[model samples]
Each structure stands twice: as C-alpha cells, then as structure tokens.
Target: MQGAIARVCVVVVAAILNHPLLFPQENTTLPDQDKELMARMREHEEKLEMEQAKLEKELSQLESKQEESSSEDGYSWYFWSTLSFVIFFTIELYRVDLTDTEIKPVEDEDVFSESGSVTPRTMVLDKDVLSNFCDKCMYTSSHENWRVREFVEGFADDLLESLRSVCDRDADMEVGDFVGIGSMFESWKVCKPLMCDLIVPFSPPDPYSFQFHLWCSPSSDVPPGLQGCGKIKVTKFGENEKGCLCGSANMGDDMLCLLHSRNDTPKVDHSPDELLCSRNTPFLAKDQVMKWFQISVTKAWGRISHKYDFEVTFRNLDAAGALTIRFRSGKVIMLNIIPVVQLEDTDAYFVSHFPSDCDSPPDPYWPLSFAVYEKNLLKHFAKRLPQNSCHLHCLQIVTFLHRKQTGLTGKSALTNYHLKTALLHLLLSKKPSVWGVESMEHRLRDLLSFLQRSLQEKRLHHVLIGNSKVPGDVQVPLIIRKAEPINLLRPLVLQRELHAATVRHFTKC
Candidate 1:
C-alpha cells in the first residue's frame, strides 16, 4: 500500500511540473511574477520527493514485519500440533473401550528395570470407572423421572377413563382396566422424551367373545414364522349364557350347549363391520383393529380435550395407538396405549405389537406378551437379590449401548427386547449372590458376552415360554410354562443377510 502511494506522489509532481499555470513551455520565456511561482513549485517538488522516500522505507519495514509474522505462525502451528498429539496419546493410554477385553497401556510397560529391560504389567480399568460411567450415561435422574411419571400417569388415567366411557357408550368395544408395562414401569428407563406403555384390555360387547388359538398348542397348524403368536377368533356366545360361564359349550355357537334354554336365537346388537373381526371369517384382523383403535382414540381425546392443558396426537399412523402429548411448556411425552386381550385372566396378554418391537407380525396373528409377568419376576428377584443388586444397572448399561448402537446404525434388527431377554435369562440362570453391586462390572461384561454369543447362535428364547427355571411365585401361565420354547431370534436367523447385519451391530455394541 505504501509503494502505491509513493508512485501516486511521483505522478502528481510530474503533472504539476508540466502544468501550463505552473511551468510554461520550455521554448517560452516566463514573466517576473511567474519566476517566483516557479521557485515555489521547485520547493513543492522537493517535499514530494522526501514524502515518496519515507513511504518506500515504511513499505520495506512492513514487508519485514510480515515475514517475521509468517515465520512465527509456522512455529506456533508446529508447537500446537505436537502438543495435541501428545495429549491424544496420553488420553488413549487411559481410555477404555467397552468392547475390548482390557484397556491398552501406555507403551508396553510402566517402568524399566535396571538391566535395561522393560517391566510389563497388566492395566485393568478400575471398577469405579465403570460405576462412574453408569452414573453418568446409563441412569436417569430418579426425582425428575418420578415427576414426569406422576404427571404422565395422572394424565393417562383421566384420558383412558374418558376413552373407556366413550367406547362403552358408542362402540361395540368394552374397555377394561389398563395394566402398565415396559421399561418405564419396570424402572430401567434411560433414554428420553419419557415413554410409557400401557396394556388396555378390551372385550366385545354382549354375545361376542375372543377365542385364542395358540401356535404352541398341540392342535395348532400355524406357519413356522408364527411361533409365539396366536390368532383371536371373534365368537358369539350362546343365547342361554348371560355371564362368565366356565364351559366352552356355553360360550360360542360353534359348540353344542350343555344347559337347556328356551331361547333359540342369539341376541346380537353389533354388526360384523363394527366388530374387529374380518368380513367373512370370525378371526380378528389386525389392520381393522388398528383402524378402529385410532378412530376411537381420536374421539376419546376430542371428548376430553377441554380438560387437559396439553395437545395429544398420534405419533405414527402405522402404529395403532401410539400417541404424543405436547405441553405448553414445550415438554413432550410419548404414550403407547396398546389394546390387548387378556389370556383368560393370566398375566399374559395378546398384543398387536410390543414397545420395543421393530416389525409387525402377519395380520390376525397377535403375539403373546408376558411383560407383566416379566415385571413381576423382576420384582420377585429383587426381593431375593443381595442388597444393592447390580442386575438393574447391568440391564441399563446394555440397553444404553443398544440405543447408542441403533442411533449409529439406523434401524437394526436387534432391539431393547433382545437385551432385556438376555438379562432375564442370565438372571434366571445365575445365583442371586452373583448380582451384588460390587460385581457390577463383571456382570455387565458377562451380559455383553452372553448377548454376543446369543446373537451368533441366533437362539435367544422367550423368558416365560417353556422356562422351567421361572419361580413359581411369579405366576406365569401354565400353558406357556408347558409350551415349547419359542426362539425370539428365529426371524433374524431365517433371513441370512439380516442376521449378519444384526450380529455386526451387536458386536459393535
């Protein structure tokens, strides 16, 4: 910039010297007064020459300073780069990768012997490190969690009661008392926008009753992929029966009546279209069930909309009754109000889908859910376990890992159900003494190792099905206890490509 200014000054002096007013043509003579103007012009030209010289000097100094700055920046860059590498190396030495068996040590040893030989030692990660990690990432704030749960449960109670009233008055459906299930109720929830699962059992009005056909039964003719699934047949009770009758003959017209009654015709109030059954067949269709459920929930929410301070809407159209409630404070909560059919007063229920389910079974074949029983079993085990058992902690950590893995790799076949199943299996197999809080790290390692092996073998079984290890106090259904073991990973195993991807995902976890 200074160099350009010096050139501009030189140009200005030349223009002034050649100007007609300042300096006339060389061949022409100047007047006396003009001579004085010429002297002043010479002085002005000298001052311009001095200013140009000063500017050139300043430009040279600026160039020198810039070169110095460039050299200094290069040195600073090298210094910081080296320092960053050293810091990274130090951190890696102490860092523990959860998937690895042991933490890598700095160099190969901590110290050198006097004989110029290296002394090696094993560097195991401290148990406190794992404990701290669980506290940091695997657990949720209990007080905050309770606050949210209280608000959610209170809201849900009102909403569901309103829904029950609506269904009883307007539809052929009779909604019963809802039973809470899933991780939130089980008390191992870690991931957020707080979620809650509810099993809302319902029955058909008047003469209609559900007839469950289990795949595990000796007379079942279900497909191979339909293991652990059952079809619900909508059957009509005989005209004579007015209440919960014991005999199958009194329940449906398909069977011959045992007791004598004067009435010959069944009193049916609901049409076939209004019911959840298929057009021709008596079996309940899942698609129709979802459609009916979505519509009923909408109407129910509409009825109680004025009572609540939040807005409720369906989270996913494909999911039957998945709802999201948004508060004025910008807080959101997810609630899954699953309509289920109780398996003859047992803890198990026939559900359309589980909260952790990634895929839906074929239409009309509802999968059996023993979530309530599982929750009970956990409670039973908790009482028997040593004080401050690490079983829940282990479960939380594995589930956290599964969540993180799912996020990294979008929509894997592996799910939270698989992780929970693995934990339950381990709990049943191992002694209660092994689950003490101090052994949390070991238990977590074992859990992961067990999960990895199970994924490899593709043989994670249903905990309540054919499990002789289950405690009698847990009250699992007798039929489920006697049935053949249903492998949960069978679907993943059948599809070779999917199974491979699922295994890779678990390994990463």
Candidate 2:
C-alpha cells in the first residue's frame, strides 16, 4: 500500500511541473528540460502581444498622415478655383465697358462749308483730334470694325502731318519748281483717296485738284474747313477761242474732289475718255491731262522712255535760235512734239515744248513748233546721257579746277586729276555729238595737269570738301561731296551742237 502511494505521488509531481502556473515552486524545482519548456511558453506569449501592439500603432499613424495629405490637396484646389473665378469676372467687366462706348456717325456739317454751316453732308475730320481718339480706341476697344476705322484714320492723320512738315520745310520753293510739284503730288496722292473714301463725306468730284487757299491757324479750335479751305470747280473748256464754263462750285478751306465723267454725274467711275481728257487738260472730267503730266514727270525724272533715243536739238544763228526735241523708237515718234521758248537772259532761254507738257499751240507756225522726228545719232546720244550727266560733268569740272589749285601728287593726285578727267571725257563723249568736238582730249590733258599742280599747292580742295569739320591736322583727302547741280545751260550745250550739225546736214543735203 505504501509503495502504491509513492508511485502516485511521483505522477502528481510530474503533472504539477508540466502545468507551470498551477505550482510555481514545483516548476522551479523541476528538471532542466521541464524548466526550459516553461521558459519557451512565456517568451512566445510576450512576442505575440508585442506584434499586435506594433501593428495597431502603424495603422493609426497611416490614418493620420492620409487625413493631413487630403486637407492640403483640398486647400490648393479651392485657391486655384477661386482665383480663376476672379480673373474671369474682371475680364467680363472690361469687355462690357468697351462694347458700351458710343461712336457717333460723322456729321454732314462738319465737312461742307467754311461758314461753320452744316449744310450739305461731307466727310471730314480734325486730324489731331482723330489721332488722339484712335490711340485711345486701339487700346480700349475690342470691336474689329471700330479698330480698323480708327487705325486707318490715325494713319491718314500721321501721313498728313508728315506732309505738312515737308511743305513747311519747303515753303520757299515755288509751285512751278520740280521739288515743290513732287511734294504736292506725293501729298495729294496719299491724302485724297483717304479723304474721299473714308473720312470726307462729299462725293468725290471729277479729276481732283488741291488748291492751297486758306492759311492754317495755330489755334487747335480752328474749324477744319476754314483751316485749309479752297474751292473745287467743275469747269469745261469751250470750243475754239471761247474761254471755259465753270459749271459746279464747292466750298473751300480744303478743296478735295474726285474726277468723274459728266455723264456719270456725282458717282465716281473709271472712264477711259475722262482719263484721256485729263491727259490733255487739268479739268474735273473723268478725262484729265494731269495724268499724262504725271506720267511725263515720272518718265523725265526716271529717264525711262519707250523710245530709247529721245533728244533735244538746238539750232541758233547769232541772237535767235530754234529748238526741236523729239522722242522716238528706231525712227518713229510715238507722240507729237510741242515746243515753247522763253528768252530769260542774253545767255539763257527757257523752253517748255513737249506733247507731254502742253497742247499743240493753235498755229503750227507758233514761234516754237511741234514736230515728230526719226531717232537719229544726236537723239540717240542725248537720251542715253540724261540731264543729270551734264550736272555730273559740271561737278567733275569743278573738282578738276579744285585739284589743279592744290598740287598734291601720287595716288591722291592721280585720283583727283587722271580719274576725274577720264570720267569727264566719258560724260562729254556720251553727250550729243552735235556739241563741239574740237580738242576735247587735249583740253582734258591740260585740265588734269593744272588740277594736279593746284592740289600740290592746296588751292581748290575747299570746293570739293563739303562741311566735313575735320581738323587741319587730320589730313583726309578731299572728295566730290554732293550731287551736281542741274543748270539751264547744260541741256543747251547739247542742243546747240545738234542744231549746228542739223543745219550743216540740211545745207549739204
């Protein structure tokens, strides 16, 4: 019985050791293997608890970070949306202001009479006022039509101011002067169309003419009509010796008209007859002689003629002389030649005779005659060497004189004398052969020698050197400084030669 009790007690002790929490003393007193098993169970429980706490903490941190990131993104989106709304509202308000601005149609009274009466409707503008208005409108208005009108008006005013400046600068020149005429044409060409088409209300009359009748006022308030007023008349020349009829009259200050045929009345239309007529006379008819005048001026200035050989031939005996000028192809004049001569001084004559210049004077036997001539040798050369050449030659001659006065040598001397002589000889030879042919080569050689000696002595250098304020110590060689002057005598020299030759040829024939 006691042995049975001992075995039961051993089994009880083993169970106690295995159940670690049931008996602490028993577990401590257990064998090494049982103690190690109890230690492993405690370690596993601690690791499981730590793992659960760590996962919970990480999840909480992720939730807080996500909430913060969402708040920042929402704030940025709200700010941009609010800013865009403000910008859109501001642009709408500005556009509304531009659209609401009023533009009154041009008044009829503003255009017609110099009396400040708004009678017949005509289009006119105060250029200074219009320019200012245009500047404001260009930046302020979004309307395309208004913008275009303003831009055009501003451009026209600017052009007019420029023209006025030019005129003021050239106030000393007469209407007959080429420079004056050219300026007038340029101004008219630019301004007339703008006035008729866009700004001015008056129906453009026939071939237009601009007459400077009224003096411009310095006061800004001066009426445009009174500031530059002049009459536009529609006149018809009578048959034979019967003067002309002034049919229609228009108010002044600014006399601008469009040329139209009488048949077309107030409307502007291109009529070949009117064009042809204007080519012969400066009338308001659709036909105008001014067109031809314009063409002739361009041709003369440009030196472009269909007839390659066109020339002026002068024949003189003692105090009296005859001048015949013609333009022709191989041997035919495309148009008639008209000639006029006005004796100015013992040494001078003013000739205005060309189909391009005037109508054939009544009598074919008028002191000056109009004739068509075949292009001959004289005609050929004259046309080839333009009037400009004569002026150039004159300048060269003056240069030669100057160099002769200053006796400089080597490259400088050769440049002044030899080079100039060669150029002068070339010019003279190119001139009509009728001009005297006697001893040109010998004369040129002597002139060159004289120029070289003059340069060495510093005699004529002043003439060639224009207003270059180089100090005397700075010795840059002098050169021909400006365009040569075109004098009346230049053309006459060639004319005289041709006349003499013609006379000799006719007499021999």
Candidate 3:
C-alpha cells in the first residue's frame, strides 16, 4: 500500500513539472490543449492523495485487529492451564481419600478364578486396609503385648539363671549363654501363648568337647530322612577315644592310669554314665538329654519356687523343655528352653528337634538349626531396608492368618516355619526398597502368591542352606550355605492328602 501511494505522488510531481505551470520558460504561451492537460493533471493528483489516505487508514485498522486477536489467545492459554492444574489437584485428593477409607474383605471372588482357586496373577491387596490392620493388631506396637513380653522375659531370665546354677552345681552339663530365637525375639509375634523360644547351649564339663558329624559331609552315611540332621560325638580333649580315662601312665601297654599299685583295682568311676551320651556310645542321645533336663528343671524350680507365686509345668512330656508358667493373675506365658550343642562355635546348633518338625527325629541324629543365624540375618538387613520396613509386618500378618485358619480347619502339613521361610526367600529375591512401610499390602500379597506357587510346585527350600541369594554379611556357616537346599515342604510330596489339606488351609488363610 505504501509503495502504490509513493508511485502516485511521483507521477503527480512529474506531471506538474512538465506542464510548464510551476517552472515556466520565459515568454511562453500555453495552447488550449496544454491548459486542459494541466487541469486534468491537477484532478488526477487530488484523486491519488485521497486513495493514499484510505490505504493508510486500512493499515492502522488491520494492525489494531491483529493485536486484539493475540491478546485473546494469551487469555485462552492461561485459562486452560489454570483449569488443568486445579482438576489434577482435585483428582489426587480424591484418590488419596478413597485409599484411606476403602476397606474390603480379602476373600473377594476377583482374587480367585471361577474354579474357586486363587489365581496368583490376578491377586491384589487392599493396601490401606491391610496396612491399617497390621499397624493395629499384628505389630508389637501394642503396649499390652509389649508389657507382657517384658514381664515374661524378665521372669524367665531369673528362672533360667537359677536353672543354670542348679545344673552346674549338681550335674556335669554346663549351661552356656542362652540364645534368643523365634518370632517373639524377632519382633514378629502376633498370637497368644506369648511364647519365648530360647536355645540353651550346654557343654560338657572339664576335658569334654563336642564333635559334629553332619549328614551333608562326604563321610556321612545318614539316612535320607536325616538330611538336615547330625550326630554329636562327646569326645575328651587330648584323648583319641571318647570319654576315655586312659592317661599317660598307661600310654604304652598299661592301658590304664597307674598312680597306684597293680593290685589297687582300677578306680571305680561311673561319671560317664551320668553324661548326656547314650549308654556305651559316644553319640549324644535325645532321650537321655530330655530325662536329665527334666530332672534338672524340676530341681531348679524347687530351689526357686519360694520366690514367685507362679507355677511352671511341662507343656508336653514329649517335648524336652517345653514349659508353661502360669501366674496368680491368670496370665500364662509359655517358654521353650531347648538345649542345643553349638556347632564348632558357629551360629548353628545341633538341636534335638526343630521347632517346626512334625515327627520326632531319630534319637541318634539331631536336626540342625540356623535360628540364630536367621535372627542375625534380619538384623543385618535392618540397615539396608527402609526405616520401619514392612517385611516383618507382612510375615506377622501371614502367620497370624495361618494360625487362625489352622484353628478353624484343624492341623495341616503347613507350619509357621514354612511361612517364615517363604518370607525370607522373598526378602532376598526382592529389592530392599520393595519393603517400605508404605508397601506393606503389596508385600503381603506377594508373600502369599509366592507361597501359592511354592505349594503348587511342592518345593519350599530352606533359606539358609544352599541359597545363593543370601547376603554374605549374614553369619551363615559356609558349609551350610553350600549344602543342598532342604525342602521344608517335602512332606507334601510324600503325602498327597496332606498336600491337599495344606493347600486348602493356605487358600482359606
């Protein structure tokens, strides 16, 4: 538009200059045609000027319209952006509210298939509800449970100390430090009985030491049923034979300690008869130990019976040291004081029976217990896991559920130890981040699903034995870690009815 206006102005100026009206030659006369042409040029100049003014006005209007349109676009963008942010915030608040308030029964049909079996893949947990229950009922956060534990443990300590003193004074068996194990000590106890499982390690007096013969060793001829068991040999130090009395004086041909004359009959001694081993055998015997322990406990209680108003009695005659203490206030606390032989100063012990064993293991062979190491493994992971981790919570919840289910359906092949084993396996397999307190529900579901799969496969291996996933920081003996993984669910393989019952119990749980 400007260019056209400029062209018109140039034409007008040229026409006026060439007309001889503005810059005239001297003595020049204009003809009529020339005068007419000058008037026409003036008219054309006026028209061009008007057209230039109209073009300028249109340019100004177009610029104003463009500015208005840009302003409207800016307002629209801001409005939409603010609206989107508000909507997102509102949705987040609603979602959180639902998560907190929504609580549903776990036995929903969506968790199972039409065939009434749990479909592991589609299973889900109501995180908020489960977490709430765990925090309220399962964890040791309750003051009543804590106080009971403290009171029971304090009384038990005094009781065990008295028992140790009695054993040392009257019997040859010397009680060592008591190792705390099981769910109570592990801070996962969720049910009644409020039991404290203690491993009382005892050694022989004076010159005696324990020699362990593990079934996993190359020289072992142990039966298949005794896979995780061992035989403990009571041997005397500095002597080739077990409990042998032959000394240096009889080293050569004498074959007898001879500080006296030959006619002085061999010093009659029957102390070996009082030892923990079987008659005429160096191997430790479970029956002998139990009998001796029962007597010792009775004597110990007799000595301390005057101090307390509670009565302590054997919970089971078959179990070596299962005791129940009943207070005058009607509070009953169970104590399992298992006598164990330490395996070469390691965390492992050759226990008379595993707490989870359903049948009595053979008397000659003692089952190996990694309970101490299990406790240590949990402590080792404490630093690695998030603060207030849900790992233990998940375990407690499952075990509590299993206990309730068992009460409803009677005994089954599944045990608490199996549930704990499954949890330990998941702890190793999953990342530490997965065990945060916020993830309790998810972890609980994962644990159940893992158990379901293990049950289906009929294989739930021991966590400490032959498990490569265990962290090196745990104090597991190298031999046990390298040994073949023993299946905790092996009974299910041999007994189909037991397997079916166990599966039903687990599903109900």
TM-score of 2: 0.15
Q: What number of clashing residue pairs does each candidate have, in the order they appear?
A: 0, 46, 0
Per-residue CA lDDT of candidate 1, range 344-439, in tens?
878788997776676788777898888999999999999999997999888887788678878898778888888889999999999999999999
Per-prediction TM-score to the true structure, in the order listed: 0.71, 0.15, 0.71
CA lDDT for candidate 3: 0.76
lDDT of 3 by residue, 317-355 (tens): 877788898988898888888888889868888887655
State the C-alpha lDDT per candidate. 0.76, 0.30, 0.76
TM-score of 1: 0.71
For model 1, where is the 10-residue window of minimal lDDT?
Answer: 115-124
Tens digit per residue, CA lDDT, model 2, 1-509: 33223333443334334332432322333456786777876676566556546655655665565544355556654555565556556756764464344223345433545644222122232445434543453323325433334543443344333323333221111112111111011111111111112111111223332221111213223233221121222232222344323235644535443533345443244343432323333322211222333333333423333323455333221101122334354321111111112121111111222222222222111211101011121233345543422322222333433344333321121232233333333433333442332333333334444443432333333211232332232222232123121121222234555434322221111
Worst 10 residues of 2 by lDDT: 177-186
Error of 1 at 53 (Å): 53
Against the hidden true structure, what lDDT does model 1 obtain? Answer: 0.76
For all predictions, the C-alpha RMSD in Å is 20.9, 36.9, 23.0
